[model samples]
Target chain A: MITAMSDASAPPVPGFVESTFSPLVHAAVHRCLGVAPPGDGARTAIVLASTVGDATTLDTGSRSLVAGQAHQPLLFMQSTANAILGRLAVDLAVTGPLLSLSTAVPDDVAGELLTTGALLLETGEADRVVLVGVELAAGDRAAAAHRALGTVPPAEDLAVALLLDRDDPVPHLPELPAHPPPAAPPDGYGTLRGLVALAARNQGTPP
Target chain B: MRREVLLTGYGVRTAFGTGAEALRDGVFDGRPAFAPVTRFDTGPYRTDAAATHGPAVPLREVLAETAAAAVRMAGLPAGARADVLVGTAGDFTALTRFWRTRGRDADAGGAAGSDGAGGAGVVETVPAWQAAALADALGVRGTRLAFTSACVASAMAVVHGCLLISSGRADTVLCAGAYLVEEENLAKFGSGFALSRDGAVRPFCADRSGLLLGDGAAAVVLESADGARRRGARPLAALTGWGVAGDAHHVARPHPEGAGLAAAAGRALRGAGLPRVGYVNAHGTATRHNDPAETRGLRAVFGPYADSVPVSSTKSTTGHLLEAAGVVELVITLLALRDGVLPPTAGFTEPDPLCDLDFVPNRPHKADLRAAMTVNAAFGGVNTALVLERT
Candidate 1:
């Protein structure tokens, strides 16, 4: 069962730069984490999903290296999605398993995220899972990947965070992709549309 | 009860060569695969070498071969569809090609992202795309999960594959991963000053400098006991217990106490119902920060028993496989259990007082063993411990 959730537009995340990936994640997670019970962090697992991870940082960092300019090793560090997940784990004091997934499965982004969350509980790894699905607005290089993804690219960075508990498992959570969007502008948001609608439903807010 | 998972076959390719036998022979002999980087000119870099495949083969092709080998060895049917979980940083060879083709222009301060054709070619550089292509190459239509958790990616792949089977989500799971040294990671490791100046990874040594990279590609086929029996497949080993945890500490550096690693190992031992592991294939990157932390984690898990069991890092032989290191080491651990010979740490100069465990060093040591553990820690403070015992 989803206990809490939030969706975020592009927002400045403090201490992170260059790409909106972490910030978008931080914005959504920061809001949802507040709904978590105090001291519940130790049992909370963090799962991050993205099709193409921080290509902006990777592209810029490699370019800097080829040109022999001073490159921020920070770019290399942040390019991997786990870096921010690690930081968030530290910040939130969550000691459960930290994991990330990269896939462009055309359908069922939310279902995939939730299924992984269920697996964490099924494996006795965690009692609660924080699932975040993030996708960046397509750039020229990312556009082709997005086209293959069969989803209309959002014009801006998109992220949604959901907090799932093991008990009261949703039998048809896997069928969420076919459901209509919850009354928002993302009646058509491709990659993260299902996640956004789910979040809205859980939050008791009209999407 | 959860279903039992068995390892029927495995495939590995390193500088030592292809098959698990080749890996065992080379690593047990304390051979080093490190050579000068042959893929490109490393003149401008700090350390211009890693344990590469030498002749230059794409990492994807290597994965394909390893995957097919594991499947063939496991005696799976030609049309058998198995879930593929891989830990990779995508097709860096394509990235290398893109860099090589665009280097002249980009290095001259030309805008890098404007090349549409060049960028499209590298879409396979993403693990998802690479993984999808791998599944297609294997001619199976099944689920594929791509893990990108840095060093421990493939280890997590193995652990989760076990979970998928035990929970009745899958019957046969193909867990595979490979990471060949590339300029992007090399530049990153160099910038971080993590590479050993001497090019030798003397794990747990008092004067240990650091780790080097290598070409590590490996795959293993895991099947439920019932599934294997129905297929009349012989089991090579049993994947008894596994655990994964996060440090909740630093992102790039391990916790000084190896807090997460201890938790993972302890969880694994508990699940395996083995109070003591016969051998431990340590993550042992030979970095100043990693060894001591691993020592603490071992102590935390084993207590006095830590001194009894043998511990060693084959990274001293294979160099570091990065993301691929864990799965390759898992295969190494299996071979050790299969033969009951613990592979040496290879380049141990002297033991650091902080690392007081009995690291089977410099030479292979024979021991009658029941089970062994392979532990891998990644950049995100994520740690995974897998226990494999004889069936």
Candidate 2:
């Protein structure tokens, strides 16, 4: 008895560095977490999926140190994938089992995330689960890294959010945009653009 | 019908080396693995000490070696497919080296996915992709979910694995987690004052300073009891139940009274239908804040059983494995249940009044144990409790 709805194209979040990944994820989650009943957040779960999680912070911090400068603690703080989830828990007041995951393959990653959300509902681990997929859009550094590793580059700045519950009446979102897999497609291409395209296509539809 | 999850086969690659036997003997022998950090230069930090893996190893190789060992030990076919759930804290070395070399001059204000993208030639080391890489390296793939919840990452991964089995999604699931001691971890943890100044791990001791990071990966092959019996596999122990809770108290520090940890333990015990926990493998990080908070958690959940339960913090010997701590400790607990031996908490010289428990200090105790519990708490107030029983 699980129901799910998804959204992408969330506006940029305020009070966070614009170039970083955390704020974008926060904005996407901010819009979707409202679908969850208030005060029921204690039983609600938040699971964030990403391929390149806040690499900007890691880049900045490490570069600074290598340049003989002191590492910024703020960058280190945002380096963990769960940093955004922690803030969302406090802001949204949902405390149940906040988690973050990363994987290379996107097609099965989203499906697995949804399945895990369903399991949480089925096992009574949470009353509802909010699943979010985020991927780093290829920056100059990221693209070069992919080329160095001899892999296709990931799509830039893609994020998708879904709210799931058990046995609830809800409309299914439209399918993600179709794209043939690039030979040796880079990891996390599916969620980066594929998932966002799904949300954009389903924008005018009812859920 | 709800399925019962059983531990069929287990393997570990820790500072002590591969296999559960090596780990058990190392702990019982009271040998601590903490030594000088060798992965990279730690000259600027307070201490250059950690339990490290000596040589450089890629994530795929470690994943392949550990998973293959566990599968072989479980008596499962080498080609058998299983759901893969991995818990990790990212590749700090890869992340740092990539950024330092390729992204050294990355635009400070350029937005990710900006117009200036796709030719920057920077290498990326995202943690999320590790699960998929690991699955491919192991050549066995089912549903995959990677967990990155700090110290409790692997513990929660195990809990998720159990859920998948209980819900009949998969009969066999490989639940594993690993972390290698690296330069970035040492620098970051040291900056946050999370490491011991003296390069020693003394859990529950009066002079305890802080935790020492360790390098290790542990894997447990979990299957439905019926499936294990069908395959003629011996069950090492029953992964009876588990509980997960969040502190919501602070981002870095645990609750003063360990409210969330106690609740987690209570939930696991209730799910297992047990009135008392005979043994506890505590998440005793030997830090000033963690030791006392864990003590409060024990007092709150176990009550009268608190004084009676033989408690030990194996981290005293293994040095904290960080994300892999939960699975490693769980394997230790399973071994203890099977052998009727309570591993000792090494480095205990004087006890603190705040931590008043029967800590099996400095000496392994031979005792019959029917049920045992391993607890793990991470940054961001995440707490997990896993309960296992003798089969």
Candidate 3:
């Protein structure tokens, strides 16, 4: 298993402006793809799981349209959650089956991502799969709504990407531990915080 | 015999109205559903025409209603163990409305410093999460997944759902694709020249321009053959094979040679152990590039038989459903197989030499269809093909 986490403030992909979500996805996907063994791109699949999705782009695009601003095609391009998935496939040349998914409940998002990766490999659809969980921290208005509703709002933006394949031996990371008290309520949305916690536990000094 | 994937139930919520009957009647009526866009302002775009479900309906409500309709059609128990997958291209009009409202408040300095909290509407806007909402709404107890692969989302979902059943991971799945006509969507596609120039969707016609957006949702209940048999469920059709491929050539345009699309069609046929395709549901979006490239793909896969096979694009009548096109076209193909009536491409006129297929133009054609194929392509250069056979 290979795992990577990008901080909430990862820089945008070079040359593409107005896309915060794609950069995070790009970073995570790059890291995970780097770890994948050399093989046929046709046998590799990707499943992206997110809660908040590309809300940053959508919110920005909607605001522009409402403000009567000029049409920004790049913004519209990134507004769809699958934009980054397509970019990843094009960039890496991996093209078996691609899926971009979101789960409403944050807690269940991580498990869903993991199970989907395993299912894809088990069904013999692909020899390898890239599983990415991403969530952009809510914007000010939405965050305020959560706080006003007494919800524990996301603390920071974050993304986690994992490379999983069938029967590939590696230093196995234990199942995620019980939730640690989040420092500052964590950041981003969905399973980012949980994924961050898992990455941290896996990277700490060996027991 | 190898275990087959069975489609036992289908439900549709489209501009023609709900259920399979509406879809059949609407297509055979030989009229395009494109009308003036009602859900949103098309701004300065050349065309403001789209196929819509009258007023805006919440995505969740449409999903629930269609899920119920599919369940009823399949005769599943009140609480069937089934997964649910939802394929959507982008946020619904309500989501954009939520953001637009928030932007207004921010501009007005009403809640700029309110610590980023949002209203109830924000809850539904979360990506991927809507699958869970749909699963809850339908009371399904199996896995819930969401997909957004542009035009190929729902078709990809159906392909994966069948794999899940074939692998014995799940017995049944509710695969649905949905889209809503929104102003943001219209402006983007219109600016990109994806919408028809004169508000007419004339696929494969000499004067073809582009596609018109459509709002709709469709769902099919898929189960393994054994599970259906044990439950005494009759198979409406068998989902025999599927092919999914990425163009990796362009962001919004298909490969000039239709390489990826041809590969997908070939893979589907090979997987199904078929020599020739009897009918093809073309992803004929009426755009200049799509029609010719799709024609090339059909020719590549069917070869000389391409001249004999009946090929038509129902988008001519229903308009383009974007992400929902995959599953919607699949359901339409299944209906064609069941009724032995090939749906027509409603707006065809003088044929383009580049597109030489025998498009069942302007009227339905009756034929003895043994197997059928439906193909769809997306903005990201993803192409998918699903092959189904009569039960």
lDDT tens digits by residue: candidate 3, B1-391: 2458999999887788888888888866667888897666765555779888778877777777887888888998977789898887435565566666767677788874443333545555543546777787787798777787777889988987977887788899999988877777777776576788787789999998888988778899999999999999989999988888776666667877787788788888988999676789999999988888889988988887989999999888888887788988998899889899999988789999999999999999998999999998876667899999998
lDDT of 2 at B203: 91
In model 2, the number of clashes is 13
What TM-score, over all chains together, does every model reach?
Answer: 0.94, 0.88, 0.92
- Can you write out model 3's per-residue Cα lDDT over A3-29, one digit (the tens) per residue? 787755777775356756778878987
lDDT of each: 0.81, 0.74, 0.76
Docking quality tier of candidate 3? acceptable
DockQ for the candidate 3 complex?
A: 0.44
Pitting candidate 1 against candidate 3, the one with the higher DockQ is 1
Q: Which portions of model 3 show Cα errors greater than 4 Å? A: A8-11, A141-154, A167-174, A177-190, A197-207, B43-45, B89-91, B103-118
Interface quality of candidate 2 as DockQ:
0.38
Error of model 3, residue B68, in angstroms: 0.9
lDDT of 2 by residue, A147-190 (tens): 44333444556556777766562233346444435444433454
Best by TM-score: 1
Compute the interface RMSD for each candidate structure.
2.1, 3.6, 3.0
Ranking by lDDT: 1, 3, 2
Greater-lDDT candidate between 1 and 2? 1
